[model samples]
Target: MSDPAALLRAYDHQLRDEAETPSAVAVERLGPLRLATFRGGRGFITYSTLDEDGRPATQESVLALVDGALAHYTASPDIHRVEWKTRGHDHAPGLHEALVGHGFVPDEPESVMVGEAALLAVDVELPAGVVVRQVTDEDDVRAMCAMQAEVFGDTPEFAAEILLQVLHRLRTRDDMEMWVAEADGTIVSAGRLEPVAGSEFAGIWGGATLPEWRGKGIYRALTAARARSALRHGKRYINSDSTEFSRPILERSGLVKVSTTTPYEWRRDT
Candidate 1:
């Protein structure tokens, strides 16, 4: 009775609409392709179905949309780099060559992963003198942000200034919180809980553990912390855009890879 494709499409739409800064965060139509910008210094490109682009729209319209959108971002001052998050299952045509022509470099395609929160909720073992807890202290948040920056290979380091800005925004609305795993006062792993209020879902993001501390179950433990937090907020489903390193773990925990996402990055300079 459930169509995975339809369900995935619906979930995608819900995430787009429920996000706080949903406009630029998910998809912003500049002309043809939707240009997406997020808080993490990341950019995204996507589009709605082009059924009405013409009397009988073809993939050419989609290609033009991408070209026009890139030109739009390259002209903006705020955007440093942009990525076109492409879905493998969508009715996209000529997207690959078009993106390459526009200077959008493709990253490895990752599973468009989905899972139930309950499946991931479980107690995990931390090393001796290690514990997982909610963290909001300036130092702890900054440390966590920096760890994330390292994991993503982003510069300008996710610093205290950026964390403060995020906190300032969180103070007015209480839909998100930060968590970290500490081993002997050192932040070993960290993540965030994002509640999509009025929806049956919450997102677990930024699950990272130091390389030396990994394979010892720290990632799973951090996920448990976030999943429990999600349940407390009345969220039933959990979602993440997972990479290869984490996909197997999620799959073992009962998540279904609903779709696939490929990011096409375009620069502002060329």
Candidate 2:
């Protein structure tokens, strides 16, 4: 068995710097952080060193970084939400405290799963009458997003809006693909596969399924479809920040949990 941590290290060293911010409208550097401004009032903060060197930043430095990023986003009237992504394996001392002190609310942590693409490409038995396929049309994408929102307990309209943004990017980003599983002409599960530019890894994101569809093999079928797509794109590995519900499924499908990621978010005051 290959070491999961080693694979994660390679992913961080080779992909973290460029794979992120591929769709950013603007990007700037502050110390070790990459400040990215995206469409839809979103701001993202990430650093390759956070995972590469594992150097712990002093509390003061962390605070300064937080303040700088917040100020950068707050100055833009269109920017409303900022996410400071933190990895559990990073040696960031007092980082969480600094973020909270700076008014960032931390979201739930998710498992960072990594595995070979071939391991996930095996055929999965879907529940009878369920069909999985790649979807590109506006109406199909909207339906998929709505089903995902309901599955994840989020606002359907908001999810659809984000999917629309992603759809716009699809015109230029052929590396990204969306897949849905349907039963009786209604979307029951949905997910996306993002093959990182100039990297061996692809990411499976936003896996969701209806409550009535849980425990079946529909989600796994959807994942396998993405994995097969990744292989076709020449990707060797698959990565995902998975919730508890999906982590076990991926693990059973041969992915390994290498770390955890938590996002600290700030919302602009209207």
- Output the number of the lDDT-best candidate: 2
lDDT of each: 0.72, 0.85
lDDT of 2 by residue, 16-112 (tens): 7557777787899877889998777788999876422355667677777778878888888988788898888887877888889878999999999
Off by over 4 Å in 1: 1-10, 17-33, 36-43, 48-57, 157-172
Off by over 4 Å in 2: 50-56
Give the lowest summed-lDDT range of ten residues in model 1: 16-25
In candidate 1, the residue pairs with backbone N, CA or C atoms under 3 Å apart (3 or more residues apart, or in different chains) clash, namely 32-65
Which has the greatest TM-score? 2
Q: Per-residue CA lDDT of candidate 1, range 224-248, in tens? A: 8888888888887888878888889
What TM-score goes with each of the models?
0.84, 0.94
